[model samples]
Target chain A: MTGSAQPRQPEAGVRYDVFHTDCPARDVVDHVTSRWGVWVLISLRSNDLRFYELRESIQGISEKMLAQTLRALVQDGLVWREVEPATPPQVTYGLTEFGRDIGEPLTELFDRITQRLSPRNAG
Target chain B: MTGSAQPRQPEAGVRYDVFHTDCPARDVVDHVTSRWGVWVLISLRSNDLRFYELRESIQGISEKMLAQTLRALVQDGLVWREVEPATPPQVTYGLTEFGRDIGEPLTELFDRITQRLSPRNAG
Candidate 1:
């Protein structure tokens, strides 16, 4: 077989291909755009948080889901999971540089969304 | 009796309050920030689309979910649904001016997200 493989087109007429089921981009989108993912990134923006703290910051997120979500984000390189060798198995989580950069815009978007719906300023 | 009901506190530290289960913002977030909601808004950014057309544009979204999401968005004033009095129930769905304005920023966010994760451009 010749070493040339045909390339597939990106979906939705955008250069991004998250719409495809087999695309790795789908996983990234899931990690970054999920309901908890959105707030998790927002909560981690300005500070480092432990696993439980992250769960606390994002209200109503179950521990199992939070751990799973964080694991995926860490694998995707948007989140860093640090485990300090301590008696209590201390683990802290924070955003990577890429996460920080990407998160700023996302947080801004969230801010705009909230502001638009604010009762005091509702349109 | 003098009416003096104290205002309830919004959830989380942010000025916006989707973190609360009871807040109406949760419903708005569910509709606007959902997996399908993200793409739906992006799809409507540049054009008006009919109900079926929207379903076709967003891959993998179930028709029931899309109908419900669109209905909620319309109620929230983020989308405009027009039902023409005609045969076969010709219904058109499009963004309101408010939707258009909100969608611009959201589309921009999706663009950045896709760009950041592009295989050739992966960090």
Candidate 2:
């Protein structure tokens, strides 16, 4: 709750259609559904992580790419960044309420792939 | 069924970790979760369509992208193509069993976005 970025509040009666060519939600979907985005969101599902922890968990994301991804997610209001006041200034990243709402279905989709589709591939 | 592309069959005992850098499932996730891919899959959920029909239904997809997306989906065994014997050889595309299985959760996610998320944005 300290120095949190201002999240975008949905304007009343502003509907978006992802199927439409110009819908803003398309960008939202694209960001959350991006390969790196999915990995980052799901990795944070268990616990908030330091930047290095997120990098380690996702395996192959470049520092530049991870930073860019985090910036996009924070802008979308799906993830929040917290900077702790300290000698070195600790930082942690976690989902916002909106992030968790979208994360529910996203994680479910991820689970469908890993838990069912993948196991089916296994002998 | 004539002239349909050979779909990849999942081999038993071969596990895939989408979280891993090199897992084939990562490709699968990337494709299906793509902005256009999600629209294509969900469009076909109600009924199969011809190539042009798919392009028209997806709103802003260029012919190249729609064609390319279908080719990838068919190769992954998530979709199948049928060529009917006729003077012009009519063609149609539909989800295979695997496509439908994968599409189930994918559609659920789409619904979560369109039905729930979008409505929340509305006044």
Candidate 3:
């Protein structure tokens, strides 16, 4: 915030500004790039899911961590969190347009890195 | 390891195969996505440096963590570790071709995410 790095209001609706130290961008990076963040992005890549469904698919994430990661993603506008006023409170989580766009590239990167680093090459 | 998820052999130089769960890819992901891994990648974006130089650029990393992270990246073939046969044995680290290629896109993504999530728009 102290620096001259002004926030970018790209394309009217989208904004990206991380140069400043105090920007909320740092928080978003911390949340989205967190240990659970990468997995959450990959999990949500295929389809939408309810709270519990997401919890189950991610394998090792605790409910608290999942919820926290989701909330952070929502705040960053990278994820959509919908709440239905149905009988039992049915909620679904899915990727926003921005989040969806990131899927292909991120997935490709993940796939490549994982593939190249397989254990057999350790020797 | 039980499945037929054999590792890939590409270009007689590069390999990538991530469908398997037990592959070393998982370990690489764990290391690179660690709290410090992302920063280390970004730090290495600039140039090669001595061990201490890398340790200083990353701000809050402990010496142990830096060494560990570098070792992991080196093991994955994404980084090269050079040791000098001098009096005190000077060492330098730099990215491999694969690592360098990943920089542009990864840095672009990091910059965008960091910029967009700045706190001013958090409301």
Best by lDDT: 2
lDDT for model 2: 0.76
Cα shift from native, residue B93, model 1 (Å): 1.1
For every model in order, what is the number of clashing pairs?
A: 0, 4, 14
List where candidate 2 sits over 4 angstroms from the true fold. Answer: A1-15, A116-123, B1-15, B115-123
For model 3, the DockQ equals 0.30
Every model's TM-score: 0.82, 0.79, 0.73
For model 3, the stretches where C-alpha displacement exceeds 4 angstroms are A1-24, A115-123, B1-23, B115-123
lDDT of 1 by residue, B1-123 (tens): 233352443444434566666566666666677777777787788788998888887778889989988877889888998889988888888888778777766766666667777644653
Candidate 3, A1-123: lDDT as tens digits: 333564543244333433233444556656666778777787889999899998886666789999988988888778899999999999899999767765655676676675445445533
- Give per-residue CA lDDT, model 2, range B1-123, as digits (tens): 243343443654344667776676777777787757777887888899998888887888999999888888887778889999998888899988767777777666655556445544444
- Tens digits of per-residue lDDT for model 1 on A1-123? 343343543343334465655556666766777877877888899899988888777778899999988988899889999999999998999999878876876776766667667755552
lDDT by residue for model 2 (A9-110), tens: 365434466777667677777788775887888888889999989998887899999999899899888899999999888879999887777777777776
Question: Which tens-of-lDDT digit does each residue in B6-118 have in candidate 3?
Answer: 45433342324332344446556666666776667777889988999888776567899998889888886678999999999999998887676555555765765653444
- Poorest lDDT segment (10 consecutive residues) of candidate 1 chain B: B1-10
Q: Order of all candidates by DockQ, from best down to worst?
A: 1, 3, 2
